[model samples]
Target: MTVKPADLLWPASTARLAIRPAVVEDLPRIFEYYRKPEVSEWLASHPADLDAFIERARQPELLACIYVVERGDIHIGDLYMGIRDAWAQKEVQAQAHATQAEIGYVIAPDYAGQGYANEAVAELLRICFEDLGLRRVTAECLAENVASWRVMEKAGMRRETVTRQASLHRSGRWLDGYGYAVLADEWRGSLVS
Candidate 1:
């Protein structure tokens, strides 16, 4: 099944957040945090300017995967969930289509350490497993980014791997990377526990 932005029930809520599809108006608030060096350092790629950010946000493909994270009227950050096919041998490849997704998030600095990331991620996992019917969901971060990995763990995703020097940072240094994942059954089990 092909997943689109419309596939998700918009304004997905956690205790303190409203996660919804990205709109043109939301891009500026998102860019506010993304433009910071501290935040941009952890991301694979970020817009260089407001215009660039808006331009990228306007794309149909990107809008489908990106979601804005908000606290009532405040824009606190953003989340991403990209659906993709899982690995399968030739004979079973069709069964793997859209069976997995990669999730990610960015919280504004002022909102860091407030459990917002954890709450938002837990909801993302719910959407991946319960709503999207994905078999598995995964996320990755630079190993040095302790907070990012911690959120994944808090959301019940297991640490799958730690690859040495797997990512090149904008600072011209190679960084170790950590991967975390959880299967649909595993996520459901986590909820029951």
Candidate 2:
């Protein structure tokens, strides 16, 4: 199971959305969601301003992937995933990729409730399992965000766990969180189903 970063494709798209690598031009649109109090409240940190976002959006050397989600040329959202060591037993880790990645996404509030997140996440699962050949992909969100967890489920990821007071919200308080994930085999089986 060897995979070099060059083997993956960029700017992948679906019927209604385009999933592409982040570009400098995406700052303004990406900032649109990052700056909103409603949007930033759930995230770990909020961008102080445009310059902060610019600094944060810079692609790093070893990224699983960071994709901007667009609709008809509009930068409506972004998706991100990064590989991390698994916490399972030695035998389980040896049998799996030894590493799994977590995924997350953000959509502009104006575009919320339109099923765009669901489509983008489903496509992301394809890229993670099929293109990147990753063994597993996971995601988590503040438990209060029903929509976010629902998107993960709609994308075929099963709820793996939940932790109370595991996350610190922008509101300066601990919040419950939900973890969801899908294995490569499970995703493939879902496609057939």
Candidate 3:
């Protein structure tokens, strides 16, 4: 789906963390972040190779969008946004239902506890809704990981369901988890000043 101006909520604010397309120059940093225990544990990773990582990022089937989180030349973390279902975003209806583009995030352990997750996700959600014409953006996380859930809920996603033993998890066994999401309209409704 192509992004149009109407799909954007607003320009990114002064969080001072600019998120731009992941370029070849970002491979080394992204590889380092992905290799970290806190991040690698959840991801399906392979041997660390910058060339391979860059190649994978260029794959079209992935619909991957990675941004290096930077503040004053300090590379803080990486933010990834991908479209799980592009067709659904293009068919957005007024029902406030989600049928496409499941969003997820990961932050370095050292960078945790800061507001990076919130700021990064807010920007991603804005693009998904405002630019892509997406009806909703959804996310899921291990129920035991309260911080991940907090990020989703804080972004205005609802508690949709709790699936038990849905799949393998970092816990080394199947774990119950929650799914949350925010529709474009619901997100707009949430921003009452």
Candidate 4:
């Protein structure tokens, strides 16, 4: 099945967060932290300014996958889960389309180390494997980002790979990267156990 924002039941909740589709009004709050060097430094790409951020967020495709993470009235962060084709041999390539997802999250620095990232990511995995029926979901981050990889581990995703000098940092240094993933059956089984 093709995964889209409409495929999810909005306001998906966890113990402490409400994960809902991002709206135009939420762009500023997202940009506020996303523009910061500390936050943007880890992201693959970021908007240079608020105008650029707004422009990028307005894209229909991106808006569909972007979700705002809120705690009551506080907008603390954002999440993304982009659906795509998983790898397949030529004969079975058609079966791969939209069968997997790549997820990402960014929590406000103020909310860091408070377990909010872990909580939010767990919800994201549930949304992907349960609501979206995705076969698998994966995430990657620079190896130096201890906090990010820890959240992935806390969410029950296994460390699938660690690549040396696999990514280029904005500061002109090659950085190692870590990839993590979980299959749908594995995720579901974890909940039962």
Candidate 5:
């Protein structure tokens, strides 16, 4: 039920970017990005230390596929996506039935607003719906994070719902969350229409 890197293609690239697996050697760069207050503000938690970051990067592949988003050789951000129901993998494979996956992304503060997140997400969605053969891909972000939701919209996802106080922020206050999703057929339709 666990999805492994070997189960999918590696080093998929866009014209201006290269998406690759997150490796142990990437720990320091990962830590640097997550440690920044601006970068970690919307995330669930900031790494306590480099060791914690290293541990996080080492999570089981079945839980999520963590990818490094790079421009040439520079580490700019990350793309995190994981299947929602492990037991449904076989049904999905055999039936071409609907299955769900979740995606999340972050970019360096300096690189904000350059359309990179949108560009990266579009490719990730192709891999999700095409390469991974998923039925739907979803993303949730705090309602206040305009850039986050905007990226989802720019990547062809629609805002499905907003849940009140869906998450407890690092500041101790609950925040509303916006859910966005796009179906595989919808995504494919966008390509031609």
Candidate 6:
């Protein structure tokens, strides 16, 4: 058996949030965060089973890095970066390239509007394009998820389109998602003098 080092992205904010790789020890707090109705409603069709989510989120091969959003060293919410395969993501990351990594995140209702999601995403995008050598990163949010869209906007991502996709929840209904992205070349060019 072998273990690889996971990249833990750090947030850029003065608030109490400190982004780092989530550990099994953080599950209790993570559970509490996901219990928020507003935060979880748009994410899936059914309610999150806290114990199940925590157990699954801890698996290493998930290609997902769960992050703990800590404020004053207390775990507040969660931020995750799932290493999806394909520019469109269908379980084939081997088919993807440095220019087309996809990403997503969530926040507890308690932490919403406090800029935690914005800061967490900035850190992930930095790691995606810089540390991971990804050329582009995409995010998809429901058409009505204004807060999520705003987060993408604040992170410099532009919405590319809106399309219907099968919902991931009990809604059992089709949902429209707004695709957004940021390119590494563009990010680099902006930093060039």
lDDT of 4 at 137: 92
Model 5 lDDT on a 0 to 1 scale: 0.82
Q: What do the candidate models score in CA lDDT, each in turn? A: 0.88, 0.81, 0.70, 0.89, 0.82, 0.68
Clashes of each: 0, 0, 4, 0, 0, 9
Better structure of 1 and 6 per lDDT:
1
Ranking of all candidate structures by their lDDT, best first: 4, 1, 5, 2, 3, 6
- Point out where model 1 deviates above 4 Å: 1-5
> lDDT tens string, model 1, 24-115?
88888888889887798898776688998789778988877888889999998999989889999999999998899999999999888899
Model 2 CA deviation exceeding 4 Å by range: 4-6, 59-64, 88-98
Question: lDDT: which candidate is best?
Answer: 4
Which parts of model 3 have CA positions greater than 4 angstroms off?
Answer: 1-13, 46-52, 60-64, 84-99
lDDT tens digits by residue: candidate 3, 32-52:
778877777667564378777
Q: What is the clash tally of candidate 4?
A: 0
- Residue 11, candidate 5: Cα error in Å is 1.3
Report the alpha-carbon TM-score of model 6 versus the true structure. Answer: 0.77
Residues 1-193 of candidate 2: C-alpha lDDT, one tens digit per residue: 3563345676788989998877677777777788898788777778787876777676463233567898997888988877666776777876555357788999989898899999999998888787778888999888998889999999999999999998877667889899999999999999999
> Over 4 Å off in model 5, which ranges?
1-5, 62-64, 86-98
Question: Residue 147, candidate 3: how far off, in angstroms?
Answer: 1.5
Residue 5, candidate 6: alpha-carbon lDDT = 22
lDDT of 5 by residue, 58-156 (tens): 776622468889998899999888776534466466444336778999898877778889889999998887777777889999999999998999889
